[model samples]
Target: MEISFTPEIRRAGLAGAGARLLGVAAVLVSLLLLLAAGPPAAADTTQVRALLHQGQDLLRAGQNDAARPLLLQARTLAQKVHFEAGEIEALRVLGKAELVHGSFAEARAFLTQGVALARRTPGQPGLADVLLALGQVANEQDDYPGALRACEEALRLYHDQGKLRDEARTRNGLGIIYSSRGDFPRALAMLLPALHQTQQLRDSALQANCLTNLGGVYFRNNDARKALYYFGQALPLVRRQPDQGALADCLTNLAVAHQQLGEFRQAEPFYQQAIAVSERAGEQAQLGVVLSDYAQLLTDLKRLPAAQTTLERARALLEKSGDVGTLAATLVALGHLHQQLGHGAEAETQAHRALALATPIKDWSVQESAGGLLASLRKRRGDYKEALRYTELAQAAHDTLFTQSKAEEMGRLQGDYQLSQERERAQALARTGERQQQRLQAQQRQLWGLGLGLAAAALAGLALWRLNRLLGRKNQQIERQRAELTELNATKDRLFSIIGHDLRGPLHSLHAFVELLAGPPLPPDKLAHYTQRLTHTLDHTLALLENLLHWAALQMGAAGPPRPENLDLAALANENIGLLTAAAEAAQVSLAHSLTGEEQAWADPAAVRLVLRNLLANAIKFTPAGGTVQVSARRTGAVWQLAVADTGRGLPAPTPLQELRPETLPRRAGEGGQARSTGLGLQLSRDAAARNGGQLLVASAGPGQGTTFTLKVPVAETVEVPV
Candidate 1:
């Protein structure tokens, strides 16, 4: 039995075969056109046109590396041939090749030159192409404003020439730019129409491009389901083409969408496919992007070793490709990988390197990512203060990007809708009465209807009026607050000035006495006796004045103590002992010093001396004849416990230990039974010790059994500083 193939089945089979044949023909034609063109002739203008066709063919074949050299050669030959239109085409192709290779600087140079040449050569078909190429370059460089301007110009030129295919391409380009800038709504509007236009023209390749761009928009808008749907639709068309560049792009995008949806199993395969295609095509820069993205995915999946290897490979590829932007991103990804693997220092180094690259490029996204990683590393090292500062910087960068994106999106939408409104108004005037009424009725129910617009305007005006009144009151309140703050600051400054001046007098007098006593103008015995007495009084007076100043500073919110430094506590104790010796002898108190263990502690030396002196002086003042005052220190497991034990009248009643407030420390009565405190010596001592990461504790065995004031200071390894 001979089976007859029906016309319908034959037709279907032929259609499918024809599509595959066309794709193969396109690839073969591209290669042949490039080879046949050869080098342009110096005086042959026709050769320039042939070279342009060759460049276009190479571009269609996704051979950017081959295309770039050919296009560049064409541009040079066109210059020699004085074929300005041909030169513009060559430049446009070169720009596109550079953009695909991630050479944004070179792309900009070529595109700018193309734009100038196109303008000079009036009525050239290449002008719109050049503009579109420039727009694509700008979009890749993240220059959204420049991209939008170029796309709009290209669209206008294409529309004027009735080039609907070119117009659709420009619309798709605009959609990609808007989507990147996070204008999803406008991106959708531009891309959906472009998709429809391509589909209507039955151009599978252009349709795939539009679908890919639309998927990107949906992904950016966080509609992963829609994004995946569009991406899937584009894939079959992309796979049918011999180039497969769009297929790789769609696969990568689908991977991202799946990753966003937490479908890592599905995403991983797509990423691998994209990477494999990029590698086979010898697209090093695109390969690096896929690898870096995959590395990030691996890091998220806790595959540290694989992520590290992938990021390193991407870095190597990016370095060779000279794409600093993607290289910086790879470095940031590596930094995160290191951070995840518990390598804080390595993470910091990588993040800093990324930041260094990103800052010069002014790529805010990379800069922000690097900065955030660095800040997190610092926080992990227990540097919250520095982390906070870096966090603020990252936040500012994010805010700037967000605000600019929002403004650009709003501006584009308003411009497009406003133009549509004007067109509708003009058409309404040109219509018949019945048609005009029908149009008005239809528009009344539309979202951007005239009635709704008028109502919105009225509400906006009312809101603005109320906002102005509220702002006026808020401004007045701010002014009053500022004035009050200024007055309060002035008062604080005056208080500090008074305390400084008052304390300086006594300090200067004491210094003068010490200077005179140090000179050789008096008898040795007389000098010794006089100096001993003067030193005792000076020490007391200095202590009193120092405490008063510190207390005043604290009250004024300016009590910032110097950081702790390594010092010998034994030496400080001996110095204060010498200063208080005469007073101890006069009071009949036996003062002794002892060191039980090698005690090294971190503390402010001046503060420690003052504390020791105050306790010693108080013991001397209150002790009876032959009473003993002992100063001793011992090491207690990472702490240096320094104790000032005294056999003196310690308490009048039940004493508050842990409940003691800072204000009560310097209020003890002297040997003269005076209730008044000369200064805040004890309070300042407590504050200084606390600042150095330790605390002061006072303990006693009831009334007259004696008291021991122990300062538990933290011990640290000595750090040397140059004088």
Candidate 2:
């Protein structure tokens, strides 16, 4: 009911009544000919035996309703004939049928009566069978002590009577009892012997049953590998035995083992097979559990959609079957699936519902699972305190289960560690001993050759020193040449980058305007707009070319001196603002400038204009529409501070310095959402400012707060050139 392979259900019904129908029918059919042969004195006896056998088979096959009447009829006939064996077998079969049908009171009455009769009539071969049947009934009722007692008595009786088959069957049942009680060592001891006995008996059904139980024992013992091995061995045998219930259980076990081993791919086929078999048999209880587990496996594999479908199907099946236990588990699985799919609210709802159902039923396993899922859901939702509470509860439940044996598990781990270390230490010691012997041999060889090699070694040392000295000088020369060449190559690459990417953008814009003007007769405003765009593109293209020229000269170490003049910084700010007006308008940004006429600076006119142009262009590109960009200049004591500022997306954090190098160019989006970077523009501006005995400084109020670029140059004392 809990699903998954661990902490298995008490009565899984894997070997359901339906799975035994074919065997029952075969036995009954063969016995039919014996009845037809003659109506002798033993007619009632034979008939009662056949009827009892058929009734037991029908009950085992899950046909409890049909088996009940047949078993009662056999009991009546046995009583009439005074046949104790037949009567006891009939009563035992009837009790088993009642057990399957959930008639605990009637089952207990019949089985108790049968047990009483078997004891009174000791030495009956069927006594062991009745006791085994009663043990199963007791086990189902959670009467562990009574069940164990019955099983042990039956096993001893079977062994004393030399009934190998019944003894093996009793061992298998006892192993399951031991597993349920958490005594896995005793379970294994019983199951392995049972497995060997079943193999010798050559009964495929019983063999498969024994193997399956062995797998269950190993699984309960936390030995998934051995469990997988036994389940794998049981699958073919069960498949041939016409027991779909067993087959499904085997397949589910195989899937769980593979899943535990993290072989998801191998696990998938077995889950599919088990689901198919359970569905075909209409075993909704088992089917629902299998589907829930399959969904979990799918979730682990990240097949979310499929897992959702499977879990929903399981939910529906559990709903109809009224299997609250499995339904709680199904909800937990669904919650985990929803969490993985990022549906936090739905996951929380499912987890709460799972906990609600599991709590009332006192199912700690389901409670633990739901608690864990709730913890994760709360954690994802940022509810740390609530998550911690659930986490503690889940851990408490988990600890409750494993705490008793924690020491045993820890001891086993410690033993494995010590064994591994011992092996490693032994290997290391062996290696060290071998190395010491080899070192001793090498040392002796060195002593013997000491005098003979001394002169040769001295001569070799002097020659090597001269060779190293020559190599060192050559390496240094090559390194110097390499450094120069690397610098030249980098400079060439920057040049190509600017020309190919930056220059091409302005050229394409001009070409587009030309094509548009040539193709259509436009309104005066439209024509003017196109003409203005063409003029702006040409100005941009010219600026790019001038920056390229400056970069080329810088790379050649032949940059010409700046042609500085005493110019009104106010006039220069206005001229550049007018030039960028069309671009600002196109980007839906407001461009304005304010400057004092008294503010005059000695700087290369072209260089100051380029700096202002690049800064303004970057501002317009990054600023959203309706934003304002303002350029202003003022006399700051001995120098004129010309500034360009914008209410646009500012430079990135740790604003890069306005260095006279290509690498300092800011990498950010501009007006058209293209990179705001233009390597030559900023570099050329910085260089030009430096040549005029000034520095270019950049300041920003972080990204989105806007930026300001200021060119600080010395004020002109004596007019050096005509303005």
Candidate 3:
């Protein structure tokens, strides 16, 4: 009924007392072997054997209270006589009784004691039994890693002794552990082989155990029909055995499988049968587990009231039984039932109860379900923060469980690989036996075959070495190209970033432009010198931004054709000269403009302003202290010419600085020292001038002589004013 593997269920099935009638059989074997060896009568070991038999009988009958004192007495008497076998058996049976009652800690203590004694006695075959019991105890407590270690060791022992049936039984136990961890593939791999072994051994009880656990794997994997088939097969076989606990488990699993398949009508009878078995055994804890699962089926039927009632009964039974894991699970089931009843607040309270219990025990399945339900409840009430918090908690629990399952699967893969190799070796020996007479002739051919194989291997190695060397050289070339591309991309990004950096001075004062256009302009010499200088700086900066922005848009094809107009070159030159005044003063350079009223050009206003600003900014930035920057404009033939000349480090052979690149670092100047690159601004201005049906020209005598940039635009056409 508890989907997780329980020691109570595992011990009641394939292993422990279920493997054989250890009571009379073990006592008879001990007596016969001792009699044949002619020893042990001096210590009254026969009386100790009698006590162990009596205790084991009561234990197998599920009478724990009656068996405990007898098992204790047997242990005491056997220890006094130093009858180690009888003492160890008594300890194992005592642990079995405790385990049957769900007292895992006490059971583990007893089983550990038994294992230590069995190990001290050399060649003790009973060690495997103790280890299997301890493994079950560890699993019930959710110590999966510890359980794996114990079960695997016991498996190795069983296989070494050629005890095929016991090995199969251990495999069944391991299958259930994997299934409980929600690892279905490995669980099936482990179960199928054990199921086949049980068939060969004709063990009805073990076959039932394997079928039930295999069905559990299928159920958890959502293959309900296959689960139902295996569970149905197990039920009748379990019924043939005297163990009511095993029968109850089989019945509960059958019901769960049927419920999973949506066969509620078929599931009800099995749940009732399991409940009846539990009541007969007087196990309130086991009864609680069945009732909890039964409520799930009821909830599916939309019988909410009935489900609530069932869960209430289960909660009371589980609380008294002190089964933490099942009790926590029952609380979550009750919470869901409460939700279906429309009692939202009550449902939350039940979920919290389950969470409190599950957290301390690290019962991740219970914690996850409880947390998920609480998250939904909070979300319904619009408490999104709390909902998110609980959702994270549930996910963490799920990931932890998943990680543990994956790690176990990896370990199982390695073990399976070794197991396959061992099987292959066995087959090879059998084949060698069948071909014994041909050994001499086979040896002669094998020698020649070995020579040919070595020659082939040497040739292949030589080819592989040459191929590796070629690949290495190719990889080096690829790395070099990749590095070059990376550098180019970085340089392009830096260039764009520089443009944006230059735009910020104007963009920051952009609000001033909006306010000035909406209000009044400053009168000449009215504001303070610093404020006056800032005003002049903002004026030309606005001009620079307009043209720069428009030029960029046109180059990207984001805007239509440029708007040509009769722009006044004299006015534009005076405005740029005013804008560069503050920058020229900061650079210790004098600036002036010479423009006549007759100068005018038919070109895009924004494009012309951008070319003028780029040339003027370059002049101010590069000009040395006490140097002069002059802006002049005139009409040359049918076009207007605007030129900015600066007394500073002149231009290189125009090609080098005109190109845009980050590594176009500053060249050493004559008197100004190393000057920063004029950079992509000039290139941008040149391209914009071409797009506007004009050109930008540059001239310099040499580095010490200074450079001059001239802009040419078409002369405007005029119509005669004849009235």
Candidate with best TM-score = 2
**Tens-place lDDT digits, model 1, residues 483-592:** 87666655454444334433443354455455445544656775675566555555556656666676567556685655677767777787888888877776778888
lDDT of each: 0.71, 0.74, 0.74
What's each prediction's clash count? 0, 8, 0
Worst 10 residues of 2 by lDDT: 1-10
Q: Any runs in candidate 3 off by more than 4 Å, and if so which? A: 1-6, 9-171, 174-203, 279-281, 379-723
Give per-residue CA lDDT, model 3, range 1-723, as digits (tens): 011244335433324654345444544654554455435555457766666776666565555665687678779878888888888888888887887788989999998999999999978848888888888888888776667767878889989998889889889988988787666887898899999999999999788888988887888899999988999888889989988877898899888888777789999999999999999998898899999999888888898898899999999999999999999999998998888788999999999999999999999998889989998998778654476568757765765566556555645554454456556656865775455435534544555577776765665567557756865786687678768755655544443444444344334334433433344444544334425445555644554455556545655577677799888887888888887787677668988887766676789998888878888877776778999988887677898777888888775544321323313435342233222342556767887788898887777777568878888889877622324
Q: How accurate is candidate 2 locally (lDDT)?
A: 0.74
TM-scores of the candidates are: 0.43, 0.46, 0.44
Candidate 2 per-residue lDDT over residues 345-393, each given as its tens digit:
9989999999999888877787889888987777666554476568756
**Candidate 1 global lDDT:** 0.71
Quote the lDDT for 117 in model 1: 77
lDDT of 2 at 555: 62
lDDT of 1 at 531: 62
